[model samples]
Target chain A: MKLNKTSRNFKILDAFYIAMMILPIIFGIVLQVLTKPVSEGIAITGARVYFTIPMPVQDFPITESQVNSAIVMVVIFFFCLYITHGMSKKIELKRQHLAEMIVEKVDSLVKENMGEYFMGFAPFIIAIMALSAFSSLLTLFGLYPPTSDINIVGGWAVLVFFLITYYKMKCGPINYLKGFAEPVALLAPINFISEFATPVSMAFRHYGNVLSGSVISVLLGSALAGLSSMVLGNLPGFLADVPLFQMGIPAVLSIYFDVFSGCLQAFIFAMLTMMYVGGAFDLETYKQKKARKSAKNKQ
Target chain B: MELAIGIILGCCALGTGIAMIAGVGPGIGEGNAVASACEAIARQPESKSSVTTTMLMGCAIAETTGLYALVIAILLIFVAPGLLVDLLVNTMNGLK
Candidate 1:
């Protein structure tokens, strides 16, 4: 192939290569000098407490997760506002189209998964999905994501557990009680314990995935810092301390752990909620009971 | 006394390592699930999306056991040893 030696594209490519070599070293040294690592060493820790409130009976400590959750809630509040701001019979803007698409998709997903009669559960399911997916993505902003906190995810899991129980009981109180002794009377205790295990497992799964991701990120970051100093230790004053190796390398791992895993866990949590709650009741029995109650009112 | 404390920490480190062995089962299980999904997709490319989504849900369920193991290991690493050592020291001082 013939080369275009003097073209504008060629010149630009040449300049990019030249800058790529010289820029990182100069910038890395400057950045290193100007800043320090957020935390000194690598160890897994709980959310830091910001303050304590002296209540009547005990002290209420406000944590990083609490603050971050408030921020996330404000963000979601504004997002809902923006999505609902324009009211028109026709969809003209891309924003309106996108909002309409999201609602329609969520509605269909619920109807498909939970069947037609449970259409009213759409808003609850959507709220859970939005809160989970958005809070999980908070890690990208360097915020302490609330979903990573066991208490936060545990609360949501408990809500799901309650919904599951409510739907199960709606069919028949007797069958709901009998579900504990499923298959045999001897296994009642085991079955009862398993009922409680569902929510605990759900909570832990989301929290563990996020926690492990952050732990790995911190360990990788500290290791890179150590490795960079070892290799570049011989550099002139102020350059030895620079994290020369951590510039672009960790982004590869971040994309998977923070973005991909975060979103996947959120989706998995929502799917499990829909499956468990939707399948809890016998649809025929539930409908029959509702019909009987309504027919009595007509009489 | 120092030896006992040292041994507690050492054993916790070992326990954490062993707890992570639970990760092995899920890895193998998910691999098998994905392999089967791939074969199914190759046979019928038109059903790729459904196949992948089903596979993902199955994999996440399979991952529950490993996630439980991770939580257990973290507790062992970060919470158990320190609390155990503190209890030991307190009892020793009380005996004095």
Candidate 2:
């Protein structure tokens, strides 16, 4: 009749997981309520004219509500951190005795299976995974997901790009750059552009898709509301009916927009990051050697 | 003016909701992957570690799609273009 100790622990973990998921929703609601009414406006203070002159745009400014919405967004961002911390903790607990589950998983996989070349890649995977999850969840509760912000994603791209380049230079700068000279030096500029394009595309692709989806969703909701009011004479058929109608529609879209697409973009970003770092470190040499061996066998 | 404001506000709300559509692909793919992995593990319990590793990797890849959608949604809500007559006037006057 006695439950196993592990079973009890799992029950506790399940409870914790539920709480972690709910916390963001609760915080988002509270924050949204507290910071309602914030919106865009012209600035009276420190307004710049061209590059040199200063001019006040407006003396009276937007109400405190406008700023509150932005503040609410900031609060939601911090809430995301909590969700990430909880997930990491849960992962750590699941991999009992391993102080760092993600690190151990990647290290053993790469060292024993993939190769020592991927030794330092585990931490990056875990960090990106956690960050993506946090950012995505914020979107669920009507907050500006931080990753969508160019400044934020761009910073991540630049940081990883530079680090990869640095590692490549340290590993073998000549060999690293030589990869760009493939086929002919005439193709070097194309190679360089392609290399740089990875980060640029990664940042904008994510921003563009998510931003467009939001716009589309808002347009649909309003259109539905308008149709309901006209047809039902404000009897609120939309309250009772439109949700059910849109459910089938938006539910399908959410599958791609929210779940599948988001995860793939995160993975692509991380995978491209690994490839960039590997190139910098001349790991392509190992790949080339492998290809050469297969070619020789065929010959 | 009311109609215009309504349009703007409605767009904002609907935009946020629709932005969530980007999540569909990752959800189905990741779900299928995890399901297949679970089935595989059930069939051959010995391959649990390998299966789990692959599952996680697939899940991670699936997650990026949702993240991209989130990015776009956030931008729509926070930085969406709107017509501000006063700002438009300032901008036109070369005083912005």
Candidate 3:
């Protein structure tokens, strides 16, 4: 049999998709079997899983969400390294082409939202997008999604908030503080609340979306399993163990909750970060800063 | 005591369902926003990219109302039940 270029590419992508689906389960099973069971400080409720982390200083329990986030970080790190390991200036390799396309897309996205001066933020935006999408999609592999954990998304929002404040301070410290009281000083408290609301809303928005999806999927999965058992429990031997209702139904739901919503939430998070942080720096102030530096140099 | 507990649970379930009605406003608002965005894109095809981006940003902002309702519903369903159960236990013991 012969395949055209498009079909050949599709075949390769299909194989990659299968590998991605299977590898995580294999890893999960291996880890489960290899690790000794420690019932203490371990809990699983709906989609939220908490495990005690054996720290060197003090043992503190952390959610499985953080662990899954770390897994995603490590995977992305190695995947990027693998793709960008080799290069040919004359001829673009497949990996190089893919990497270039990703970079170009991220660059344009950042430029469009943040403008030309803030193009430096492209990498950070890309990282946030990639991490958010990957962590949320990890739910499909039966791993807890970090974004579903409020702490993880809250941390990201805090970082963005800090960046925005830092940029405002950098532009003009006194001006930044004074600007809050502008139009009317009586509205300062309201302004303060609105200012703080940005990060809070951003965090909750991502967390709520992912957590809802996780909770819904868990509910559906268990419902199916329960129905299967009620129907097939009388069957002898291995037949009783098969959750037949759960075999194919959840996959359809996963496409929306895990794949589509995950990608959309990630995009929204990145877009908000870019918009808020980019908006903090005034182009006029930046120009003034540049002009002041030039005058100092001449003197 | 069991009857009181059941009533508490039933009321919470009902309240959570009611709280989710807040979703209706955002659903309509988002539909209108998307319609306007589509209209704008149709008028100026070259500006589709920017129009879509702005529409998405507006949609996300509008989603806050729905998200708040969701948060409240989740708390009603999960967190309130345990706390309510604890309170009822304490009250029953006090009565004893």
In terms of TM-score, which candidate is strongest?
A: 1
Which candidate's lDDT is highest?
1
Per-residue CA lDDT of candidate 3, range A98-117, in tens?
A: 88889999998888889998
Instruction: Estimate every model's Cα lDDT from 0 to 1.
Output: 0.83, 0.59, 0.82
My TM-score estimates for the predictions, one after another, are: 0.87, 0.53, 0.81
Q: Which stretches of candidate 3 lie over 4 Å from their true place?
A: A1-29, A32-59, A222-247, A289-299, B90-96
lDDT for residue A244 in candidate 3, whole number 0-100: 96
Clashing residue pairs, backbone N/CA/C < 3 A, model 3: none
Higher-ranked by lDDT: 1 or 3: 1
Instruction: Give, for candidate 3 chain A, the lowest lDDT window spanning 10 residues.
Output: A40-49
What is the lDDT, from 0 to 100, of the residue B80 in candidate 3?
94
User: A265 in model 1: Cα distance from truth in Å?
Assistant: 0.8
Q: Which CAPRI tier for candidate 2?
A: incorrect
Give the candidates in order of TM-score, highest first. Answer: 1, 3, 2
Best by DockQ: 1
Q: Residues B1-96, candidate 1, lDDT per residue (tens digit)?
A: 999999999999999999999999999999999999999999999999889878988998898999999999989999999899999999999999
Candidate order, DockQ descending: 1, 3, 2
Looking at model 3, residue A277 earns an lDDT score of: 90
